[model samples]
Target: MDLIAPVVLTRPAGRNAPLAAALRAAGLAVVEAPALKIERLAVAPPVLQVGDLCVFVSRQAVDACFDGRCAATPWPDGVRAAAVGAATAQALRLHVPADAILAPAEGAPPDSESLLAVIEAVGLVPGRAHIMRAQQGRDWLARQLQARGWSVYCHALYRRSPAIWDRDTCAILAGPGRCTLLLTSLEAVDAVADSLRRQAMDWPATLKLVTLHERIARRLQCIYADRPADALTVRLSAPDEAALFQAILASARSA
Candidate 1:
C-alpha cells in the first residue's frame, strides 16, 4: 500500500468497509474518517402501511426498513417508488418494485429537484404520497406536494449524526496521511473538520478527496482554500461509491 496514498473514507461506518477494500486494491492505505452517524427510526407497523407513494431517500433508509423489525409482507401493490439518485434508485429496485424512479443526468448530482420532477409526472395529490428518509432532511418535495394539493407524510427512517474523531485519527489527518476522503454530504465534511480542530491539528491537504456532486465539490474547494489556497480535490460527477472508486482508480493510474 502507498503509505503516503491513504484514502480518507468519510462515509458512514456501514459503508466504509467496501470503500476501504477498493482503495486497498489500488495499493493505497485506508484511513477511515467516517463523519456521518446513521440510526434507524422505529414506526408502528399498522400506522405506516397506508401510503400510496413510498419514497426511499437514501440507501440506508431502505436497509433499516428491513432490519427484522418491520413486516415481511410486500409493500402495498398500489404504491409507487421514488429514489434520490441512480444508485439509490437501483438499491430500491433490488427489494421493491419502483414504479417511478428519477435521477439526474449520469454526471450530475441526484438531488431533491430531480426527484420532484418525477413526482410531478405522477400527478400526486395531497396526502397521497409518503416520503421515507433520514430523521431530518430537505422539505422541498413535501412542501411542493402539499402546494399541489398532495398530502405528503414524511416518516423519518433514520437519523444522521457526526462521527467523533479519536486522538489517533485526528493526528493522522493532521499529517500527510495520504488518505482519499470520499465526501457524500456537506454535513459530513464539516463534521470531520470540526472534529480535527477539537484535536488541535492542522487540516492538511495531502490526502485525495472525492465528492459525489458539484455543489459539494465547490463547498469543499471553498473550505479547503480558506486554509491552503491549493488543496488537491476531485468531483466524481455521480452520487455513488462505485463510480467514485472507479474515478479514483483511473486518476491514480493516469498519475
Candidate 2:
C-alpha cells in the first residue's frame, strides 16, 4: 500500500508535537492541527484529610496537577493515586511512589470501567476520591464512585476547548489525497466536525478517522453519516499514542 494520506494529529498542541515528530520519523506527512487547546487552570490541590485517592483522568491532567510546584509540595502520607491507563499512571508515578499508584490490571482494558472494577476488587471502602481532568469531561466514573458511597470531587485542572483554526489549517484539511484524523476525545470529534462545517471545506468522502474509543467513533459515525460506505472509522482498544500509531499504519496498509 502507498499510504500517502496526510495524517492529522488532533491532540492538544504541546501534546501533539511529540506524536507528530514520531509520525514524521515514520515517514508519514503530518498535519498538526489540534482540535482542542488545553489551558491549565491556576488552582492548587486542596488539603486532604487522609485516605483520599487522587485519580488522574489523562496525562494532561497530570501535567496540570503535578508538573510544577505541585510536585514540590510534600505529598501527604497514606494518600494513594489512581490512573485509568498506563500513560496516566506513568505520569502520576513521576510524583507519587509507584507502590502508591493504582491502575487497571494487566490484560484488562485501560479505561474507566476496567479501573473501576479493579478499585472495587481492591475493596476500597466508601471514601473521598478526586478526579483530576479537563473541564467539562465525562462524569461517569465519578458517578460510579459516588454510587458506592464514595465522596467524589472533580477537579478541573485544565480547560479544553475547540481550537481556533487559521487559514493554513483549513488548507491542510482541504488538501489533496485521503486524510486520516487521529482524534482522542469525544470533544475532539465534535470540534473537528464543527471546524469542518465552519470552514466550509469539502471534506473528502474517503477520509479515515482513528479514535481512541468506540464512543468517539460512534460520534464520528453520526457526524459523517452522509459519507460513502467505504469511509473508515477505526477505534483502538486503548487511548495511547502507541495504539493510535499502530492503528494508523494498519488501516493505511489495509486501505
Candidate 3:
C-alpha cells in the first residue's frame, strides 16, 4: 500500500480507534483529531411494547441504550429495531437479531430519507415509535413518522460536546502536505471550523474532505464559501467503512 497523505479522523473519542487502526495498516498516516466528545446521559430504560418501532440514530445511541442500566433487559419480542444506516444497523446487531433489524439497502446513503423509504416499504402500520438519539439532532425522521400517523417519542441518550484540539494537532491539519479529513456529521464540520478559527488559522488550500452525506458536504461548502472553487475539494461517501475507505483513497489519488 502506498502512503497517500495523513488522514484526519474527527469522530468522537473512542470512536476513531477502529478506523485509525485500519488506515494505519493500509500505510496511511493517521491523525486522531476528535472534533466532538460523546457524553452519555443518564436516562431510564425505554419502555417498549409489542408492535412498536424502536429506531437508533447512531452507534452511540445503540451503546447508550444498551448500557449497563438496560443491558440485561431483553428486547421485546414483537418490537421492531431499525437504524439510520448500515453502520448503526451493524452496531444494533450486537443486541438484536439481524432479521429484526431494518435499514436502507447496502450502498444507499445512510440517512433519514433512505431509512424512511425502507420503513415505508415494509408497510408497517402506523403505531408507536421511539427514536434514540443525542440531546439535539435533525428531527426529519420523527416528523416524517408522525406525518404518517405514527406516535413518535424521542429519547435523548447522550450529548455531543466539541473537543478541543491541541496546537500540535492543529499544526498537522494546517500544514502544507495534502490532508484528507473525514467528516461524518454537520456538528463535526462546525467543530473543526470553530477550532481552526479559534487558532487564527484559515482552511488549508491542500485540505481535502470526504463527507458521509451530502448534507454535511453542503454545510462544509457554506462554511468555506470564501475559498476559491479550486481550493475546495469534497467527496461524498455512504456512511459505511467500505465506502469511506474507498472515498479516502480516491481523494488521496486525486491529490
Candidate 4:
C-alpha cells in the first residue's frame, strides 16, 4: 500500500520514538513531533495534611511525582490517588503504596473525563486535590472542581512545548506528496498548520489526517474542507502506540 500521510504523532516525548518505530514497521513514514513535553518540576512536594487527594493526568505525571522533585513530601495520609488511565496508575506501583491508585475504565475517556468519573465513584469531595501535571495543559478537571467549590492546587509536575521542527519534516508538510498526517494534540496541529501557512504551503489536498478524537478532527476538517476529498480524517481510539499503529495501517490501506 502507498504510504498514507507522513504520520505525525502527538504523544508525549518519551512515547514518540516507539510510535515512530511502530509506524515504520507498518511500512509508513512518521514525523516525530511531540504535542506535549513532560518536564519534571524541580520543587519540593507540598506538605500534605492527614488526608488529601492525589491526581495525575498521565504516566509522565506519575513519573514526575516520585522523581525526587516531589520526594521530600510523601503522599499525605489517607490520600488515595486517581489517575487518567490504567497505564498511568500502574506506573505508580513503586512510589505510591499499592492499591492506593484507581483509574477510569480503559477507553472511557482522557484525563478530565476519567478524573470526574473516578471522583464520583470514590464518593470523595474535591478537597485539597494536588494535581500533578505537565505545564500548560488542559484545566477541565480543575475548572469543574472549582465550579463546585473544591480546593485544587497544581503540583505543576511537568510541561510540554513544541519541539524544533527539523528540515526534512518541514519539507514534507509543505511539499506535494501522497502522504497522510496524524495530529494527536491540538497544539501540535496549530503549530504545524501555522508553520505551513507561514511558508504558503502548496501541499496537495489529497493528504489524510489521523486524529485521536473527534473534536480536534472536526477543527482540522473545517480548516481544510475546501480541499480534496482524499484529505480526510481517521480517529484513533487511544493515544497508545498500538492504537496509533492501527491508525497508520488503516489509513495506508484506505483507497
Best by TM-score: 3
Clash counts per candidate, in order, are: 13, 0, 0, 7
Q: Can you write out model 3's per-residue Cα lDDT over 51-140, one digit (the tens) per residue?
A: 999999999999998893556777779899999998899999999988888999988888999999999999999899999999999999
Question: Which residues of candidate 3, in runs, are more than 4 Å off?
Answer: 1-5, 68-70
Candidate 3 deviation (Cα RMSD)? 2.0
TM of each candidate vs. truth:
0.84, 0.90, 0.93, 0.82
| Local accuracy of candidate 1 as per-residue lDDT tens digits, 1-255 | 335655667778877788678778878667777888887777632244444666667788667665634456665665566777877777877667545454444654587777777667656554566777777677887887777787677877778888889878877664543455677887887788888888876666555567777777777777667555435556464666777778666544333
- Shift of residue 126 alpha carbon in model 3, Å: 1.2
lDDT, model 4, position 239: 58
Reference-based TM-score, model 4: 0.82
In angstroms, the error of model 3 at 151 is 1.3
- Looking at model 4, report the run of 10 residues with the lowest lDDT sum: 196-205
Better of 1 and 2 by lDDT: 2
**Local distance difference test scores for all models:** 0.68, 0.77, 0.85, 0.69
Error of 3 at 46 (Å): 1.0
Model 2: CA > 4 A from native: 68-70, 235-237
Q: What is the C-alpha local distance difference test score of candidate 1?
A: 0.68
lDDT of 4 at 102: 67
lDDT of 1 at 89: 78
TM-score of candidate 2 relative to the true fold: 0.90
lDDT tens readout by residue for model 4, 1-255: 555446666566676787688778767777776644456768755666645777887777777767754466555568878787656777776677766776777676555776687788777755787788777778888888777767889877766665555556666664545566777667777767655555556444566677666777787777777876657555556655577678777876666
What are the per-residue Cα lDDT tens digits for candidate 2 across 1-255? 536768888888877787777778888888888888888888886566578988888999888887545546866888888998877887787788888788986545667998898788888767889898888987889999999999999988889989867656866754666677787878887787677778776555666777666777777677568877666556464556676677776654555
The residue ranges of model 4 lying beyond 4 angstroms of the native Cα positions read 35-38, 69-77, 174-177, 202-204
